[model samples]
Target: MKKQLLVAVSLCAGFIASAMADSRVTIHYPGQSQALVLQGAANLEQLTLRPELNGRTWWPGTVIAERTASGIQQQTQQQTQQQLLARLSAFSAALRGDNDGELAGSVDRVRTQLAAMRVTGRQFVPLDPDWIRLHAEANRRLSGEYSVYTLSRPTSVQVVGVTTPAGPQPYQPGRDVAEYLQTHQRLSGAEKNVVWVIQPDGKTEKVPVAYWNHRHVEVAPGSIIYVGFSSWSLPRAYRDVNEQIVSLLTHRIPD
Candidate 1:
């Protein structure tokens, strides 16, 4: 009887141990030919201590995606994309009857670019190892696959929306937001007083660029300078389109 009891206890313990095992994680470093695969890391804290990650720079905009959440993330992105597309189509239709051909052309250009961009199901999580180590959730087990990308610093910023000469421009240090606008010609419907700056880390800022309300907001590298459509030009239902565009741009996968 004693032997049987001991055997049952051992089996139960083994089952629990197996149930708690951590999932595999893959870490990708910049310029490295090979990726480091790890298992048995209980959480972000344990994963950060691996010798393979030692002495590497951790970019503030580092992206971590869990494979388990990819499907749901993809669905969410698709819904958002579809909504944005619908809104853009409505904007185009409304502008068709209006006298502003330049504005209509600008909207069409943005719609085309958005439709062509690829949507990856990857969802970004903050997951900074330095912060994780000091947090209460450090002991929580990490599940599914993880990709830790240490990307190189970007050297250019993308300028888009309602502007000529839109696209990537060489990033200049200490240049204010208004200076960047000077290089590009804002379309008739573009906002004159402000622009939205979407940073690499998914943070958005409203920056004043017009002379009277001009505030010296510095544009960051890899950021997108979105010159939005003027509020008066957009119908009531589409007034939030620019904000939605900024949100989508924030989630965009790094190139």
Candidate 2:
């Protein structure tokens, strides 16, 4: 009788252990407060966003999974090929609609983004075969099997300063001074030797272009880029103008 009771207790514990092993993964959508908890092999196809956006698609974005005593815990995913194709399609459509010849330069920018994404741990990773595999492996390794992502638009950053044909211009994704100088006609005539990034925090950071590719540089949304001759090299009149332009173009955080 005691042997039978021991056997029953062992079976019950085994069931509880199996149940605990089958954990769920969490995914967060853009502009939403709540998160989705999925169990086992949650692929990109399983992800659905609310109030679908017209021109936006799901791109892998990082988020804080939880806040601990140590610091904020971040969750990320591997990139997929579908996201790349979607972005390329959008850029192609933009090129087709380019009546002003300005968008002709965007092709190279799109290619640059594709190139930068070749490596791992990129900021924006799409859901592809490899990504899904990685996601599964990650879930198996981590507790709670947590994952988070967001939807994003193609072009987030705005460009303004001396290089634009008009006053301000829009920069496509993955574009930097390297690609910008290649396509836009240089109007300043003073030699655009400096590239300045005006961040959302109202701070300026100088970006030096080593090659026309400038593969390592990127800017955030609403940030302004100033491309022009260095202020030190310019005459006082020109320097004042450049500073004023950069100052005015700076992005201000909402009060």
Candidate 3:
């Protein structure tokens, strides 16, 4: 097995600044009614094929070999909001001021919408070094095992979307970055799983397996891979994760 490029993003939001020293963070998500203390960072892809490092940043998506009752689907923040809105549409109809995700086949639409944003845990009131408060305004009616919340304002999502009805967005890698790594090349067998790399655009990068040819490779923060996913991983997951959370304005979170 090789440490493929993985992007574990989103879960980094709302971390308690009380970080120890090395790289441990206690994240308190909305609807969680609890906090998650994760050390190091990793992604579902990396953790699936390698060892986990405590106290590091994390990644976003997971590459599953097959689908299950709970499979991950890539989605944009707008899509997430639209889906949530649709859930409560019957009670709160769009007064002709809606952007999308309305009308006809709502039941099936709701299921598909959730299926896409579904990570592996409860939906969250995404937080950040800055303060942002999202409430269970819309999805309150449909809340259950998977809690939900709505942003106070609009936000953007960066993860790449694949196999969408509209198809994945244009993802042409940058020439500057591509050329830089090509010139700096000096990796060996499986030892190359040092730090994962992700483009700011939200698309994931592989953990380059040029070193030992082993299955796994570790990485550094802001380098690559954010959070990890697996059977032994965290009990909860997050959907609609974004950068620079701006939902809660009551308090300012520390970066």
Candidate 4:
């Protein structure tokens, strides 16, 4: 597949410097954990999806037929799956402070692995170079400070007035839904979920999956993102995965 558009958004709380030369990254994939030290100029594809990464498995003709349009055998089907998973994972990681997998390993793993495991409704998404850069910066930011900021000052958001398996829980807006799910693993397996944004002036808006993926849909201080159920699986499975992640920063699953 041809490369898609890449946007470089700087979400740093303060300061921007020249991109670093070399960086070490740890990628946690389903059934895999890859660690690589990379040059800033290195493209993500080098580490993610390549013929070698799959270990000498040539593209199955049928898998190619489904993924490529007509003459785009440049990349294989497995490569595509890996690319999409990486993008989804990075976005989910950004939601609540730095509790990427730790806060919700069980739930996040389900979301990450299931999306990779699905047969139909799969699409290849180009790796977001900016995401890698942002991650590197976040890592560097943490290294300079004596203590990580996540511990000193917590990072969280609120979901107001939502019913759950526990029933009528208070809308305490201090923890990101992703972080909440990490500790409360009981509510992870629900099949369907929806996302709602509570505006500043007592207004509410339902955000579509596409809207959430756009870099423009940033979460502000008082904005409330609440996930509700529409169905077991979303219109597009990737959409379900993406929404689940954004909802982790702003989700509400009912029991």
Among the numbered candidates, top lDDT falls to 1
Which residue runs does candidate 1 get wrong by more than 4 Å?
1-21, 24-40, 48-58, 67-70, 98-100, 119-125, 134-141, 145-150
Q: Write the candidate numbers in order of decreasing lDDT.
A: 1, 2, 4, 3
Better of 1 and 3 by TM-score: 1
- Each model's TM-score, in the order given? 0.78, 0.34, 0.20, 0.21
Q: After superposition, how far is residue 228 of candidate 4 from its true place, in Å?
A: 11
**What digit string (tens of lDDT, one per residue) describes model 3 on residues 50-115?**
222212222222111211234332123344445444543432233123532332233233234334
- What Cα-based lDDT does every candidate model obtain? 0.75, 0.43, 0.25, 0.32
Residue 207, model 4, lDDT: 46
- Candidates, ranked, TM-score: 1, 2, 4, 3
Candidate 2 Cα deviation (angstroms), residue 193: 9.5
Clash list (residue pairs), candidate 1 = none
lDDT of 1 by residue, 1-255 (tens): 999999999999997776566767777776776988878776766776677654454445555556655556556776888889888987887787776676778788777766765443444444556666667664456776666665667888888888887788888999887888888988777888899998876788999888799999897788889889899877798888888887777766565
Global Cα lDDT for candidate 2: 0.43
- Please give the distance, in angstroms, between residue 164's alpha carbon in candidate 1 and its true position after superposition: 2.1
Whichever of 2 and 3 has more lDDT, that candidate is 2
Provide the lDDT at 145 for model 1: 66
Return whichever of 1 and 4 wins on lDDT. 1
